[model samples]
Target: MSFILFLRQLGLSLAEIKAILTSDYSEQTLLLNKKQALQEEIARLQALEQTIDDQLQQVNQQDTLQVDQPIHLRVLQRLPFAQDFDLSVVETIDWQPDWMLRQLYYVINETDYAICMATPAVSDYQIDAGCYVTTTIEAASGAEFDSALAAITTHQTLPLIGIEMRGTFLSPGKHLAVKILGNRKE
Candidate 1:
Protein backbone atom coordinates (compact mmCIF):
# COMPACT_ATOMS: atom_id res chain seq x y z
CA MET A 1 0.00 0.00 0.00
CA SER A 2 1.09 3.59 -0.56
CA PHE A 3 2.80 5.00 2.56
CA ILE A 4 0.35 7.88 2.81
CA LEU A 5 -2.62 5.38 2.55
CA PHE A 6 -1.05 3.15 5.22
CA LEU A 7 -0.66 6.16 7.49
CA ARG A 8 -4.30 7.15 6.85
CA GLN A 9 -5.48 3.60 7.64
CA LEU A 10 -3.52 3.73 10.95
CA GLY A 11 -5.58 6.82 11.90
CA LEU A 12 -2.60 9.18 11.74
CA SER A 13 -3.71 12.77 11.16
CA LEU A 14 -2.64 14.65 7.98
CA ALA A 15 -0.28 16.90 10.05
CA GLU A 16 1.41 13.84 11.63
CA ILE A 17 1.88 12.18 8.21
CA LYS A 18 3.42 15.38 6.81
CA ALA A 19 5.72 15.72 9.85
CA ILE A 20 7.14 12.22 9.42
CA LEU A 21 7.75 12.73 5.68
CA THR A 22 9.55 16.07 6.19
CA SER A 23 11.61 15.12 9.32
CA ASP A 24 15.35 15.94 9.21
CA TYR A 25 16.53 12.30 9.48
CA SER A 26 14.06 11.00 6.82
CA GLU A 27 15.92 9.18 3.94
CA GLN A 28 14.17 11.09 1.13
CA THR A 29 14.68 14.48 2.85
CA LEU A 30 18.44 13.87 3.46
CA LEU A 31 19.04 12.63 -0.11
CA LEU A 32 17.23 15.64 -1.61
CA ASN A 33 19.28 18.13 0.49
CA LYS A 34 22.55 16.43 -0.43
CA LYS A 35 21.67 16.48 -4.13
CA GLN A 36 20.91 20.22 -4.00
CA ALA A 37 24.20 21.00 -2.20
CA LEU A 38 26.21 18.99 -4.76
CA GLN A 39 24.54 20.83 -7.65
CA GLU A 40 25.50 24.19 -6.09
CA GLU A 41 29.11 23.08 -5.60
CA ILE A 42 29.34 21.86 -9.19
CA ALA A 43 28.11 25.20 -10.48
CA ARG A 44 30.74 27.10 -8.48
CA LEU A 45 33.54 24.85 -9.77
CA GLN A 46 32.40 25.28 -13.39
CA ALA A 47 32.60 29.05 -13.06
CA LEU A 48 36.14 28.84 -11.69
CA GLU A 49 37.18 26.56 -14.52
CA GLN A 50 35.86 29.03 -17.10
CA THR A 51 37.84 31.89 -15.54
CA ILE A 52 41.05 29.84 -15.70
CA ASP A 53 40.41 28.93 -19.32
CA ASP A 54 39.96 32.59 -20.25
CA GLN A 55 43.26 33.52 -18.65
CA LEU A 56 45.02 30.72 -20.46
CA GLN A 57 43.63 31.92 -23.78
CA GLN A 58 44.89 35.46 -23.13
CA VAL A 59 48.38 34.22 -22.36
CA ASN A 60 48.46 32.10 -25.50
CA GLN A 61 47.40 35.04 -27.66
CA GLN A 62 50.17 37.23 -26.27
CA ASP A 63 52.72 34.54 -26.93
CA THR A 64 51.58 34.22 -30.52
CA LEU A 65 51.85 37.99 -31.07
CA GLN A 66 55.38 38.08 -29.67
CA VAL A 67 56.48 35.28 -31.97
CA ASP A 68 55.18 37.16 -35.03
CA GLN A 69 57.19 40.28 -34.16
CA PRO A 70 60.60 40.67 -35.78
CA ILE A 71 63.78 41.72 -33.94
CA HIS A 72 66.65 43.34 -35.91
CA LEU A 73 70.08 43.84 -34.36
CA ARG A 74 72.98 45.79 -35.86
CA VAL A 75 76.40 47.03 -34.78
CA LEU A 76 76.06 50.78 -34.27
CA GLN A 77 79.73 51.53 -33.67
CA ARG A 78 83.07 50.04 -32.72
CA LEU A 79 85.26 52.28 -30.48
CA PRO A 80 88.85 51.49 -29.39
CA PHE A 81 90.68 53.32 -26.65
CA ALA A 82 94.00 53.21 -24.74
CA GLN A 83 94.00 51.10 -21.59
CA ASP A 84 95.24 53.96 -19.34
CA PHE A 85 93.40 56.91 -20.88
CA ASP A 86 91.81 59.60 -18.65
CA LEU A 87 88.02 59.40 -18.47
CA SER A 88 86.96 62.92 -17.42
CA VAL A 89 86.49 64.33 -20.93
CA VAL A 90 83.21 64.72 -22.83
CA GLU A 91 82.55 63.96 -26.52
CA THR A 92 79.72 63.37 -28.99
CA ILE A 93 78.85 60.07 -30.69
CA ASP A 94 77.34 59.80 -34.18
CA TRP A 95 74.55 57.43 -35.16
CA GLN A 96 72.36 56.52 -38.13
CA PRO A 97 68.63 57.28 -38.35
CA ASP A 98 67.74 53.60 -38.47
CA TRP A 99 69.89 52.69 -35.48
CA MET A 100 68.73 53.00 -31.88
CA LEU A 101 71.12 52.74 -28.99
CA ARG A 102 70.21 49.62 -27.03
CA GLN A 103 73.14 47.94 -25.35
CA LEU A 104 76.86 48.39 -24.68
CA TYR A 105 79.40 45.61 -24.30
CA TYR A 106 82.81 46.19 -22.66
CA VAL A 107 85.45 43.59 -23.42
CA ILE A 108 88.50 43.61 -21.16
CA ASN A 109 91.61 41.89 -22.53
CA GLU A 110 93.76 42.97 -19.58
CA THR A 111 93.43 42.15 -15.89
CA ASP A 112 90.15 43.03 -14.18
CA TYR A 113 89.66 46.70 -13.27
CA ALA A 114 87.12 49.16 -11.94
CA ILE A 115 85.67 51.98 -14.06
CA CYS A 116 83.50 55.05 -13.48
CA MET A 117 81.42 57.29 -15.73
CA ALA A 118 79.46 60.46 -15.01
CA THR A 119 77.66 63.38 -16.57
CA PRO A 120 79.54 66.64 -16.11
CA ALA A 121 78.27 68.27 -12.87
CA VAL A 122 75.26 65.89 -12.93
CA SER A 123 76.09 62.38 -11.69
CA ASP A 124 79.05 60.20 -10.78
CA TYR A 125 79.13 56.37 -10.93
CA GLN A 126 81.47 53.34 -10.85
CA ILE A 127 81.58 49.86 -12.49
CA ASP A 128 83.80 46.80 -12.00
CA ALA A 129 85.29 44.95 -14.98
CA GLY A 130 84.29 41.45 -16.06
CA CYS A 131 84.89 39.22 -19.11
CA TYR A 132 82.30 41.61 -20.52
CA VAL A 133 79.91 44.08 -18.89
CA THR A 134 76.50 44.68 -20.48
CA THR A 135 74.13 47.56 -19.82
CA THR A 136 70.78 48.71 -21.20
CA ILE A 137 69.31 52.20 -21.03
CA GLU A 138 65.89 50.62 -21.41
CA ALA A 139 66.17 49.49 -17.82
CA ALA A 140 65.99 51.58 -14.64
CA SER A 141 68.28 54.48 -13.73
CA GLY A 142 70.76 52.25 -11.91
CA ALA A 143 70.98 49.97 -14.95
CA GLU A 144 71.51 52.96 -17.25
CA PHE A 145 74.50 53.94 -15.14
CA ASP A 146 76.30 50.71 -15.98
CA SER A 147 75.37 50.99 -19.67
CA ALA A 148 76.71 54.54 -19.69
CA LEU A 149 80.01 53.28 -18.34
CA ALA A 150 80.34 50.71 -21.13
CA ALA A 151 79.52 53.36 -23.77
CA ILE A 152 81.61 56.22 -22.30
CA THR A 153 84.77 54.35 -21.31
CA THR A 154 85.44 53.61 -24.96
CA HIS A 155 86.68 57.14 -25.92
CA GLN A 156 83.54 59.04 -25.00
CA THR A 157 81.49 57.17 -27.62
CA LEU A 158 78.30 58.85 -26.39
CA PRO A 159 77.59 62.54 -25.79
CA LEU A 160 78.51 64.11 -22.44
CA ILE A 161 80.29 60.87 -21.57
CA GLY A 162 83.12 60.92 -18.98
CA ILE A 163 84.91 57.90 -17.55
CA GLU A 164 87.72 56.97 -15.13
CA MET A 165 89.43 53.58 -14.87
CA ARG A 166 91.33 52.16 -11.89
CA GLY A 167 92.79 48.86 -10.70
CA THR A 168 94.11 48.12 -14.19
CA PHE A 169 96.59 45.97 -12.22
CA LEU A 170 97.11 44.02 -15.43
CA SER A 171 100.30 42.12 -16.28
CA PRO A 172 102.47 43.83 -18.88
CA GLY A 173 101.38 43.59 -22.56
CA LYS A 174 97.66 43.31 -21.74
CA HIS A 175 95.09 45.48 -23.55
CA LEU A 176 91.34 46.29 -23.54
CA ALA A 177 88.60 46.48 -26.20
CA VAL A 178 85.10 47.91 -26.21
CA LYS A 179 82.24 47.44 -28.67
CA ILE A 180 78.87 49.15 -28.89
CA LEU A 181 75.86 47.15 -30.13
CA GLY A 182 72.56 48.62 -31.18
CA ASN A 183 69.16 47.48 -32.49
CA ARG A 184 66.37 48.66 -34.79
CA LYS A 185 62.82 47.57 -35.59
CA GLU A 186 62.43 45.86 -38.92
Candidate 2:
Protein backbone atom coordinates (compact mmCIF):
# COMPACT_ATOMS: atom_id res chain seq x y z
CA MET A 1 0.00 0.00 0.00
CA SER A 2 1.54 3.44 0.79
CA PHE A 3 5.00 3.63 2.45
CA ILE A 4 3.60 5.72 5.36
CA LEU A 5 0.74 3.21 5.79
CA PHE A 6 3.11 0.29 5.81
CA LEU A 7 5.46 1.97 8.38
CA ARG A 8 2.48 2.91 10.47
CA GLN A 9 1.31 -0.72 10.43
CA LEU A 10 4.80 -1.84 11.54
CA GLY A 11 4.83 0.89 14.18
CA LEU A 12 8.46 1.93 13.19
CA SER A 13 9.64 5.46 13.85
CA LEU A 14 11.44 7.61 11.22
CA ALA A 15 14.71 7.24 13.16
CA GLU A 16 14.45 3.42 13.00
CA ILE A 17 13.73 3.51 9.25
CA LYS A 18 16.76 5.70 8.70
CA ALA A 19 18.97 3.23 10.61
CA ILE A 20 17.73 0.30 8.44
CA LEU A 21 18.52 2.24 5.27
CA THR A 22 22.07 2.88 6.57
CA SER A 23 22.61 -0.86 7.16
CA ASP A 24 21.41 -1.64 3.68
CA TYR A 25 23.86 0.91 2.24
CA SER A 26 26.70 -0.72 4.19
CA GLU A 27 25.94 -4.17 2.75
CA GLN A 28 25.82 -2.72 -0.76
CA THR A 29 29.25 -1.09 -0.23
CA LEU A 30 30.78 -4.43 0.82
CA LEU A 31 29.31 -6.16 -2.23
CA LEU A 32 30.70 -3.45 -4.52
CA ASN A 33 34.21 -3.89 -3.10
CA LYS A 34 34.08 -7.64 -3.60
CA LYS A 35 33.02 -7.20 -7.24
CA GLN A 36 35.88 -4.76 -7.87
CA ALA A 37 38.48 -7.08 -6.39
CA LEU A 38 37.29 -9.94 -8.60
CA GLN A 39 37.46 -7.76 -11.70
CA GLU A 40 41.08 -6.82 -10.94
CA GLU A 41 42.06 -10.46 -10.45
CA ILE A 42 40.47 -11.45 -13.77
CA ALA A 43 42.39 -8.71 -15.54
CA ARG A 44 45.71 -9.90 -14.11
CA LEU A 45 45.08 -13.51 -15.19
CA GLN A 46 44.17 -12.44 -18.70
CA ALA A 47 47.42 -10.51 -19.03
CA LEU A 48 49.47 -13.54 -17.94
CA GLU A 49 47.63 -15.73 -20.41
CA GLN A 50 48.45 -13.36 -23.26
CA THR A 51 52.14 -13.40 -22.31
CA ILE A 52 52.21 -17.21 -22.40
CA ASP A 53 50.56 -17.26 -25.79
CA ASP A 54 53.18 -14.89 -27.17
CA GLN A 55 56.04 -17.07 -25.94
CA LEU A 56 54.48 -20.12 -27.53
CA GLN A 57 54.18 -18.33 -30.85
CA GLN A 58 57.88 -17.44 -30.78
CA VAL A 59 58.89 -21.04 -30.15
CA ASN A 60 56.79 -22.22 -33.07
CA GLN A 61 58.46 -19.72 -35.35
CA GLN A 62 61.93 -21.01 -34.46
CA ASP A 63 60.79 -24.58 -35.14
CA THR A 64 59.56 -23.57 -38.56
CA LEU A 65 62.92 -22.02 -39.44
CA GLN A 66 64.70 -25.20 -38.46
CA VAL A 67 62.42 -27.25 -40.70
CA ASP A 68 63.51 -25.22 -43.72
CA GLN A 69 67.09 -26.27 -43.05
CA PRO A 70 67.70 -30.01 -43.31
CA ILE A 71 70.79 -32.06 -42.47
CA HIS A 72 72.42 -33.54 -45.64
CA LEU A 73 75.11 -36.07 -46.78
CA ARG A 74 78.30 -36.02 -48.86
CA VAL A 75 81.50 -38.02 -49.48
CA LEU A 76 84.79 -36.70 -48.20
CA GLN A 77 87.42 -39.24 -49.30
CA ARG A 78 88.37 -42.74 -50.64
CA LEU A 79 91.63 -44.68 -50.74
CA PRO A 80 93.27 -47.57 -52.61
CA PHE A 81 91.55 -50.93 -52.07
CA ALA A 82 92.97 -53.85 -50.03
CA GLN A 83 91.94 -57.44 -50.71
CA ASP A 84 89.32 -57.45 -47.95
CA PHE A 85 89.36 -53.81 -46.95
CA ASP A 86 86.55 -52.75 -44.70
CA LEU A 87 84.12 -50.20 -46.08
CA SER A 88 84.74 -46.51 -45.39
CA VAL A 89 82.51 -43.40 -45.64
CA VAL A 90 82.98 -39.68 -46.25
CA GLU A 91 80.81 -36.70 -45.52
CA THR A 92 80.63 -32.91 -45.97
CA ILE A 93 78.22 -30.61 -44.18
CA ASP A 94 76.96 -27.23 -45.36
CA TRP A 95 74.99 -25.11 -42.94
CA GLN A 96 73.91 -21.54 -43.28
CA PRO A 97 75.20 -20.30 -39.94
CA ASP A 98 77.28 -22.75 -37.88
CA TRP A 99 76.91 -26.54 -38.06
CA MET A 100 77.26 -29.14 -35.35
CA LEU A 101 78.98 -32.52 -35.97
CA ARG A 102 75.74 -34.38 -35.19
CA GLN A 103 74.49 -33.57 -38.68
CA LEU A 104 76.73 -36.24 -40.22
CA TYR A 105 76.19 -40.03 -40.23
CA TYR A 106 78.85 -42.73 -40.74
CA VAL A 107 77.62 -46.11 -41.99
CA ILE A 108 80.04 -49.04 -42.21
CA ASN A 109 80.20 -51.35 -45.19
CA GLU A 110 78.20 -54.57 -44.87
CA THR A 111 77.17 -57.35 -47.24
CA ASP A 112 74.13 -55.20 -48.02
CA TYR A 113 76.33 -52.23 -48.71
CA ALA A 114 73.72 -50.26 -50.64
CA ILE A 115 71.12 -50.30 -47.87
CA CYS A 116 73.52 -50.19 -44.94
CA MET A 117 75.61 -47.48 -46.52
CA ALA A 118 72.92 -44.96 -47.39
CA THR A 119 72.52 -42.44 -44.54
CA PRO A 120 70.74 -39.15 -43.95
CA ALA A 121 74.14 -37.64 -44.72
CA VAL A 122 73.75 -38.11 -48.45
CA SER A 123 71.18 -35.92 -50.14
CA ASP A 124 68.92 -37.44 -52.77
CA TYR A 125 69.59 -34.24 -54.70
CA GLN A 126 72.40 -31.66 -54.82
CA ILE A 127 73.14 -29.25 -51.96
CA ASP A 128 74.74 -25.83 -52.34
CA ALA A 129 78.21 -24.77 -51.32
CA GLY A 130 78.42 -23.52 -47.70
CA CYS A 131 75.77 -26.17 -46.99
CA TYR A 132 77.16 -29.39 -45.43
CA VAL A 133 76.49 -33.18 -45.58
CA THR A 134 78.10 -36.67 -45.35
CA THR A 135 78.12 -39.89 -47.44
CA THR A 136 79.15 -43.58 -47.13
CA ILE A 137 79.57 -46.37 -49.71
CA GLU A 138 81.34 -49.68 -50.13
CA ALA A 139 84.58 -49.11 -52.01
CA ALA A 140 83.88 -50.40 -55.54
CA SER A 141 85.50 -53.87 -55.69
CA GLY A 142 85.06 -57.28 -57.41
CA ALA A 143 81.91 -57.17 -59.49
CA GLU A 144 81.01 -53.69 -58.27
CA PHE A 145 84.44 -52.42 -59.18
CA ASP A 146 84.03 -54.08 -62.61
CA SER A 147 80.71 -52.29 -62.93
CA ALA A 148 82.55 -49.02 -62.96
CA LEU A 149 84.82 -50.44 -65.63
CA ALA A 150 81.91 -51.55 -67.73
CA ALA A 151 80.23 -48.21 -67.34
CA ILE A 152 83.40 -46.43 -68.37
CA THR A 153 83.85 -48.84 -71.28
CA THR A 154 80.30 -48.38 -72.50
CA HIS A 155 80.35 -44.57 -72.17
CA GLN A 156 82.56 -41.69 -71.09
CA THR A 157 80.54 -41.15 -67.90
CA LEU A 158 81.51 -43.32 -64.88
CA PRO A 159 78.33 -44.60 -63.26
CA LEU A 160 80.34 -45.51 -60.16
CA ILE A 161 81.09 -41.80 -59.74
CA GLY A 162 77.45 -40.85 -59.77
CA ILE A 163 76.80 -38.37 -56.94
CA GLU A 164 73.56 -36.95 -55.63
CA MET A 165 72.66 -34.06 -53.30
CA ARG A 166 69.81 -33.40 -50.91
CA GLY A 167 68.50 -30.39 -52.77
CA THR A 168 69.38 -27.96 -55.58
CA PHE A 169 72.24 -26.43 -53.56
CA LEU A 170 75.73 -26.17 -55.01
CA SER A 171 78.24 -28.78 -53.82
CA PRO A 172 81.98 -28.74 -53.24
CA GLY A 173 83.49 -29.42 -56.69
CA LYS A 174 86.39 -31.55 -55.56
CA HIS A 175 87.23 -35.15 -54.72
CA LEU A 176 88.00 -36.24 -51.14
CA ALA A 177 90.34 -39.04 -49.99
CA VAL A 178 89.72 -41.76 -47.38
CA LYS A 179 91.68 -44.93 -46.44
CA ILE A 180 90.77 -48.61 -46.01
CA LEU A 181 92.38 -51.70 -44.38
CA GLY A 182 91.39 -55.40 -44.12
CA ASN A 183 92.49 -58.95 -45.09
CA ARG A 184 93.73 -59.27 -48.67
CA LYS A 185 94.35 -62.36 -50.84
CA GLU A 186 97.35 -60.99 -52.65
Q: What is the C-alpha lDDT of each candidate?
A: 0.36, 0.34
Cα lDDT for residue 78, candidate 2: 30
The best candidate by TM-score is 1
Candidate 1, residue 173: Cα displacement in angstroms equals 53
The weakest ten consecutive residues by lDDT in model 1 span 161-170
Candidate 2 — which residues are off by over 4 angstroms? 1-25, 62-186
Taking all chains together, the TM-score of candidate 2 against the true structure is: 0.21
Which of the numbered candidates is closest to the native, going by highest lDDT? 1
* Residue 135 in candidate 2, Cα distance off native in Å: 34
The digit string of per-residue lDDT tens for model 1 on 83-186 reads: 33223321233332211112222333223322222112322222222222222222224344455556544653332212111111121443232222221123
Which ranges in model 1 have alpha carbons more than 4 Å from their true place? 1-24, 62-186
Q: Give candidate 2's whole-model lDDT.
A: 0.34
